[model samples]
Target chain A: MTPATPRRRGRPSRTESADTPAARDRILAAAREEFSERGYDKTSVRGIAKAAGVDSALVHHYFGTKEQVFEAAITLSFAPAMEAPRTVEEGPLDGVGERLTRFIFGVWENPATRKPLLAIVRSAVNNEAAAAVFRRIIVTQVLRRIADRLDVPDAELRAELAAAQLVGIAMLRYVIKVEPLASADPEQIIKRVAPVVQAHLTGPGL
Target chain B: MTPATPRRRGRPSRTESADTPAARDRILAAAREEFSERGYDKTSVRGIAKAAGVDSALVHHYFGTKEQVFEAAITLSFAPAMEAPRTVEEGPLDGVGERLTRFIFGVWENPATRKPLLAIVRSAVNNEAAAAVFRRIIVTQVLRRIADRLDVPDAELRAELAAAQLVGIAMLRYVIKVEPLASADPEQIIKRVAPVVQAHLTGPGL
Candidate 1:
């Protein structure tokens, strides 16, 4: 008896199908551009689908909703709290300031991360739902983790202060596009700003 | 003719009419309320007029456009850079940090100033025109003065960094309503965060 060849089922295999990582990337890229250019309220699933040359249902299949697609588009993989604690854990505690500062500047300086970050800031400021998402991400992923790691008597206060300092720098230099700051030397900023971040993290004040 | 019976001319005397400080106050209060609730974009002159219980033209008379009305509603008679420089000028060059920090905290801590400041932030974030007005106000009224006062080589950079830090703290604590930060004790925040601000202003690294 001859063995029958396996029949391909639902969606065709990659070689036989049009869907690819390239397509997914194209869709997300279009989504980011649309969201940033027109804002969240005006951007539409159909528009993104057309921009990516895919059907609307394909977008739904890949990302459940406009909100979910927006999230996927602006996803920040850099977990500062996770990496920051490790930095704090290693090396002399005194240098923790410099390390943390370097990490922050590095994240912002990297183009891959900065674009999405800027989008998040612009959207959060422009839309209520996006702002709520932003607030949640900061609270749960960044602030909560950092606050938990701090040994300070007022850990929560210290964490909020730290978040303010970092986020503030991001806002001024990146979002507002203030001159000199927008073009300042990254190393110089890190050198000067780290100690202050360090102080907020582990400095001696109440 | 008996000198036209001593006629009162231009606009009828508000004293003779129903117009009162109480009425004006009611209108201004309502304007602020509406602006805060709906933002500058969603708000209309007629809407503000309705909220204030006056005719739209009356609002125009008192304050020309919605922008003008917003400016009137939120104008700060006290200038930070003006008073802040005076405060810091008295202290030793090294003490600029403490002095500047104290002055900024003083402005933000006062409810009279804080409410108007919050209104400006809300308006600025939501409306491009408002944001431009805000940027102009900050540049001419705040940053330019601060930059002029600095003896550092990167005086402008220093001033901007200082502005970012100060504004960031206010945004998180007052506008975004981030927990622990939103409700954290002001004095503790000042003590912990002020030195970082001072460092940005006059730190040795710069």
Candidate 2:
């Protein structure tokens, strides 16, 4: 080993040559796999670091803690779809419902991307800590972003109600697997649900 | 003890004088508490019997297995609101959404009744057996009845969608406790949610 090579105090040998941006992405991906397979409570930091072929200190160096790792995984899972909220920023408010519905449905209906989200929702249903983290992500990363694009009164409440409608459908579709909704035409669901979402976003109250 | 009284085999001394309809109700209530406090995998018949202060055999006599006890408790928890399907039986179809939403919100928003229902939802999320039972009840006791009342072409699909929406809202408001929706006024929620639900029940597709 070169004496000039940087070494940390009480740290294990590096699993790879050096840290790079790709290393952080690799760690996040490994975290996703571990969390989705075993859920929040069962996954460990060392396990994720090992799977990522990085030192345990490297895992801690990148994400700091297991909870933070999960948070970053959520960002990785959702960052693509989170851009949909920004779609609301540029488009007519009327199309927001269809755009939003199609966005979420498109993301969740795909098995590859759906695994981590499913793990998070199922974990949140039973574990308080997971639920807290899940809630923070949904509220801050997703709903609040969409609400910020709106000019409506009570935008925050409307944003959440809109979220509830879609979240509920996803729960029945994926978690509870309620038939019809579980297997019904996604376009049909979007058609039926979009108007309500639009109304929540910009309609006069009853 | 009187010789006149007949005792069942392998039974503990009568926990109470004799079985009555009220005794059955007590057993059902105790079963609800056990299943709700602990998820399905953790709850047992003996624990329920002990909680109800009855012999374990008496519990078996009333409800055959752990699954049966769970179904009965779900039935008991849902029976009051299950009648909303009947509201559709007599009311105009357009108002079915409002009636249905009002009924569920009434049941769930009230803490006294929400406990058992919450247990069922949380339990169903993780336990396949509990999920099966919950699905059966949602299909036969709830959605099917509402669907039967409709003359729409895809009544069953529509019924399930409506269920998806309400179930999602209930999940957010109570289970996940998402902000805004969680604290939103029940009546206001019904007002806002009703129209969307109505559209899902009766809309022309996109």
Candidate 3:
């Protein structure tokens, strides 16, 4: 460890070897596994650091507290799904529903992304602190982004209602693995559910 | 301990006092508290029996297994929501969506029902066995009933789609408690969300 090694001074000390991006990614990955397997209440910074083969100070250095670790891990896992709001912005307003639905499901359909997502949802469901982190991320990063782009009244409510429809489908089909819905083709679901989502986002009042 | 006390023949033996409806109810109530507090994977029949102040044998005799106990508790907790399907059968097909939506939300809006339902959802979310129990009860008891009554083509799929919408709303508003949607007035939500639910159940193809 050289005195000349770059450091973000004033933060708690960390091993220079643990400061690399690879080390950070490893810690984040380990945090996901610990949170997924043990859930939010049971997972700790020490556990994550041990799993990552790094010093405890390193986990704290990279992510702060256990809750911050949870936030960082969830933010990474939810990154793909969170990008769906961008789909809402890029497409014509009329087709945003199908585009957003397709984009969100596309993220869920892939096993790599889906596994972490499943872990995130399970943690969020089991722990209130995890749920609060999840809520803030989804609302501020995802739903609010979509709401900001919308021309409709009740835009935030509309964004959440749209989100609820998609989130529910994910719960039943993926998490709960409810039949027919679970086994049915993904495109088939997008076909049926997209318009209702569309209506919630842009259609006239009930 | 009267020899004349009625018992189901050939089952595991149990105390007569533990076999009464009050005892069974006590056990079931205890099981809910245990599962809710501990979640499905961590909760045990022994724990539930202990909480209810009864012998483990009596819990087994009455509920059979931990899964069965979960099924019974879920069935009981979901009883009110399950009854919403009957409203579908009673009303004109045109009005089924509003009636069904109102009925389902009504179950969630009340704190007494909401807490157990929240527990059931958390259990389902956390464990596949619990999810299976929830899926079966919902499909056979609730969604299937609504599907059976719907005259539409693709009835089961349609029923599930509608359920997905409401379940998503409940997951967000009640369980996840996302703001705006979480704090929105119940009737306002029903008014806005009911039509999308209706569309899923009965509206024209997209």
* DockQ by candidate, in order: 0.23, 0.35, 0.40
Q: What is the C-alpha lDDT of each candidate?
A: 0.69, 0.77, 0.84
Report the Cα lDDT for residue A8, model 2: 32
The total of clashing pairs for model 1 equals 0
lDDT of 3 by residue, A20-47 (tens): 9988998998888788777787778987
Which parts of model 3 are misplaced by more than 4 Å? A1-16, B1-16
**How large is the i-RMS for each model, in angstroms?**
10.7, 7.4, 6.7
Q: Judging by TM-score against the true structure, name the best candidate.
A: 3
**Per-residue accuracy of model 3 over B39-125 as CA lDDT, tens digit each:** 787788977887777788989989999999999988888888878888898968889888998998889999988888988998888
Task: Looking at model 1, give its docking quality level.
Answer: incorrect
Candidate 1 interface RMSD after superposing interface residues: 10.7
Per residue, candidate 1 scores C-alpha lDDT tens digits across A93-124 of 67877877687777788887776666566666
lDDT score, candidate 3, position B51: 73
Residue ranges of candidate 1 with Cα displaced over 4 Å = A1-31, A44-70, A76-92, A147-153, B1-99, B106-112, B122-133, B147-153
Candidate 1: the clashing residue pairs are none
Model 3 TM-score, 2 decimals: 0.90
Write model 2 residue lDDT over B79-155, tens digit each, in one string.
77677788777778878778778877888878888877777777787677888888888888878788878876788
Which run of 10 residues does model 1 chain B get worst, by summed lDDT?
A: B1-10
Alpha-carbon TM-score of each model against the true structure: 0.67, 0.82, 0.90
